[model samples]
Target: MGKLGGEMKALAKHCGGSHKTVNDCIHIVQRFDHHLLALNVHIQRVAQIKVRHIESYIHERLAQGIGKRTLQNEMASLRAVLQQAGRKQVAEHEWLTNKSLGLAGASRSGTRQAITPEHYHHVLETARMKDPGLAAALELARLMGLRSQEAVQSVQWIWGMGTGVGGMWRRCMGKFDSWLRASSGWSRLPPFTVSERLGGGGKYQAALPSPLQSKPESDRTNVEINERTCPE
Candidate 1:
């Protein structure tokens, strides 16, 4: 396909199947187009995009305050839509899918300041004194490194037992510990964690449905009762 033709087709698919408005589609597609242009790629050949291209696109979008999950969803939707257009290869090579392009937000290289040991300890201790949810959340955030909403949404029912607080806590802590290195204040770095920004929602919790148990060491992803991996 010619340059204009490819743009037209991608735009058509994006508008009809994407956000449902030409205006929004234009913005999204234009952003996509701009990124491709910067990378010296064309719309028709977007299916040939590699993980590096996706990293650039994600870094651009993440700069706009789009949440990591939301960005993941957008990319996922885009990938599916592209696949329907026989462009699944584009999605397959994305940073999200391939885990290349080690971008960082609020990390050692990000613009945001890393949380200090004192601050981390403070949040943990304060939560311990006041709210168990807050305390559990702190462990998830400061220790387990769960995103705010993940920690919040993690409150659900478990099998054979009761709820999924332990399930959530275990997962959160496991992730936090895995990346021993400090996160740049807000960099969209690799091995993304589930975290809500500080002072955002500021409060979330769930009661222990049963006796909370730490996830098995072997089960690193903390696959346990009530722990659902976010749909990709």
Candidate 2:
């Protein structure tokens, strides 16, 4: 870790929360510190943080097109850090509030659209042309409803299965094959059911039904073969 990271980590130790929450607070504060550094404001400690600094940070982020929801979360994290530093007045200052910063209420409305088959195929082909390994990883992420890091880690887990690692690969693939046989179509399949017991630290467990599952056995075999043969 760099100087800013170390400082943020020390400040985060004063915070009270779960491990993830503390780490998240540290990350946000580190970002703020980096931003201050960029602006030629050398704030080496949290005690140096002022309402003006936060207001300036907010305005800079807003100008950079940061979303209201994200800004709200950032402000909350900063507030926690500031409060821990015994700067309650500065933390609760009106100028630092979301409303005062012109940050609207965060919305929970779902706006994501599922990837269409045509688009998926097009991107897959393009990725294949660039790198077969990347194409395979992309397929794994899509079929398993995994984030990029999860897909990579899952592949590693699969390779390490017989070495007393775990059975996540076998279980996920078995569930995927079963879902393939039972589902009518893959154009609008339900979201994958995440198993919290099996998935620690927000990693997904079960594989979801995907359009590739609707393909012929030969095509499915090709994907599996690609996954196995692709260079790590």
Candidate 1 overall Cα lDDT vs. reference?
0.48
Q: Enumerate clash totals for all models, in the order shown.
A: 23, 0
User: Can you write out model 1's per-residue Cα lDDT over 1-232, one digit (the tens) per residue?
Assistant: 3563355346455545322343444455456666777766764554455556667787877788776655654565555545556665555663466235333232233456878888877877888888877776555454334467544544431111233333333344323323221221121111333343355554322332222346677855433222454221
Candidate 2 lDDT over 16-131, as tens digits, reads 77555676788887778878888888766767777898999889999999999888988988887777768899999978778899997678697899999899989999998999
Best by TM-score: 2
Total residue pair clashes for candidate 2: 0
Candidate 2: TM-score? 0.58
Q: Cα deviation in Å at residue 43, candidate 2?
A: 3.4
Local distance difference test values of all predictions, in order: 0.48, 0.64
Worst 10 residues of 2 by lDDT: 180-189
Off by over 4 Å in 2: 1-5, 10-27, 83-89, 105-108, 161-232
Q: What is residue 85's positional error in candidate 2, in angstroms?
A: 5.1
